[model samples]
Target: MTDFITTELHTARCLLRPWRTEDIPLVPPIADTRAISWNTSLKFPHPYGEEAARTMVSWSQADAGVDKWQFAVFKDGQLIGGCGTIRGEDVHAHTAVVGYWLGVDWWGRGIASEILAALVDYMREETDIEQLTATCFGWNPASRRVLEKAGFRNEGVRKGVVKKWGKTTDLWVYGMLL
Candidate 1:
């Protein structure tokens, strides 16, 4: 198991905190209403209601003591999204994968970018990690742009790389060296 660093991070208009039970109310709608599940690896039952939220919160806390780090993104004092770093093998432990999504209503407001910036800075200051990577569906230009604005460079695309919602899709890889 890998160890993770946890901290409260702030952005110009948002606050990023560890997940809590209070976040359940926001997760379902955000997960269900938005087209968010299409481009990411979230399970189909996302916005997974109260029971799922409880399980996730508990799982996240347990993972934190090892290698996974997840944070709830808040704006106006309300949970609006989430961000996290997932650990890989020991040889690549100094590196992490990044993933996040915001509520559909919050789109185009630069919230994801704000959270990404904070996450990057937090990793640089709090860990030995020197690189962060992200992957997006080939069709998600908006997500590609977010990564670019956050200082990630496009590496390349892998053909038929992901099978989401029962169909195979290509994936674009992005990377940022800290």
Candidate 2:
């Protein structure tokens, strides 16, 4: 297996780097917001607590140098959110699924777009990945805009593919080739 090194990526306003145990305390409060959780995968707990934050930090640390690349998004030296890519296996090994989320307080500021563009560039330069894919809830136009701004194109939507928080939602798929 090839060993990969995790490094910090900087944008104009944000810093993307590997998560530290110290970051656990900053996660739950930002992640627990309903606005943030509803647009993300179900794995992101809505009632996100200290335990969940600890688990995530631990998992992120363990996944370092592996196929999973998770980064803590920091702005002004404060942990504000995260973004990552999980590589596919077997015949799909060249592909990766990207995901990201920001604190509700940081929404509508183009932070997500900047972070995503930097992440995409980092992946292209550091890895052999061929394609990156992302999905957004159909109702989340902001996320769609972010993906598009980062050069991902809309593929299609899976109708009512996710049933979360007592509601069924469509999943809008987006992809980019590197």
Candidate 3:
């Protein structure tokens, strides 16, 4: 199993903490939009609801502050987004995949950029991971921008590798070494 470094981190305008059961009630209202799910991942489908939130929170609750790296992003004590890492095992144990998402209402405020930078700094300082990776669909320039602003390099792209919403799209991969 992979080990995580910390449970909580703070950016200038957000507080990132481990997921809580209480957050189950807050997730759907912010995460159920097609706009978010379409660009994020298949795991987070449109119309995401309490059950998905329960699973996400439960997956992190037991491992919070110790083993799991995913965090719930909060602004002024309200759940606004999430950011975290998934560490690789076996020969890739020194690397991790990073991801983050925010509610639609909060877009374009530099929040994700700030949070991503802070998460990268935290991982570099607190974990054994040597490399960090992030990916965005070809249509997601906003996500690409966030990753680039966090000092990640556009390592490469895989054309037509992602099929989402019945359409094939490219995948842009970014990486940073700590």
Which candidate number maximizes lDDT? 2
- Candidate 1: tens digits of C-alpha lDDT, residues 1-178: 1234346888999988878766776677666753877767764355457676667677677757346678988888878888888766779987889988887888888888889999888777776677899999987889998999999999999999887667887899999998
In Å, residue 23's CA in model 3 sits off its true spot by 1.2
Q: Which scores greater on TM-score, model 1 or model 2? A: 2
lDDT of each: 0.79, 0.89, 0.86
How does residue 71 of candidate 2 score in lDDT?
Answer: 92
TM per candidate: 0.88, 0.95, 0.93
lDDT of 3 by residue, 1-178 (tens): 2234235687889988767677899999999999998897888877898999998888766645344478899999889989888877788878989999999999999999999988898888877779998999999999999999999999999999999889899999999999
Better of 1 and 3 by lDDT: 3
Best by TM-score: 2
Error of 1 at 29 (Å): 2.6
Model 2 RMSD in Å is 1.7
What is the RMSD, in Å, between candidate 3 and the native fold over all Cα? 2.5
Quick one: ranking by TM-score, best first? Answer: 2, 3, 1
Judged by lDDT against the true structure, how good is candidate 2?
A: 0.89
Error of 1 at 171 (Å): 0.3
lDDT of 3 at 46: 77
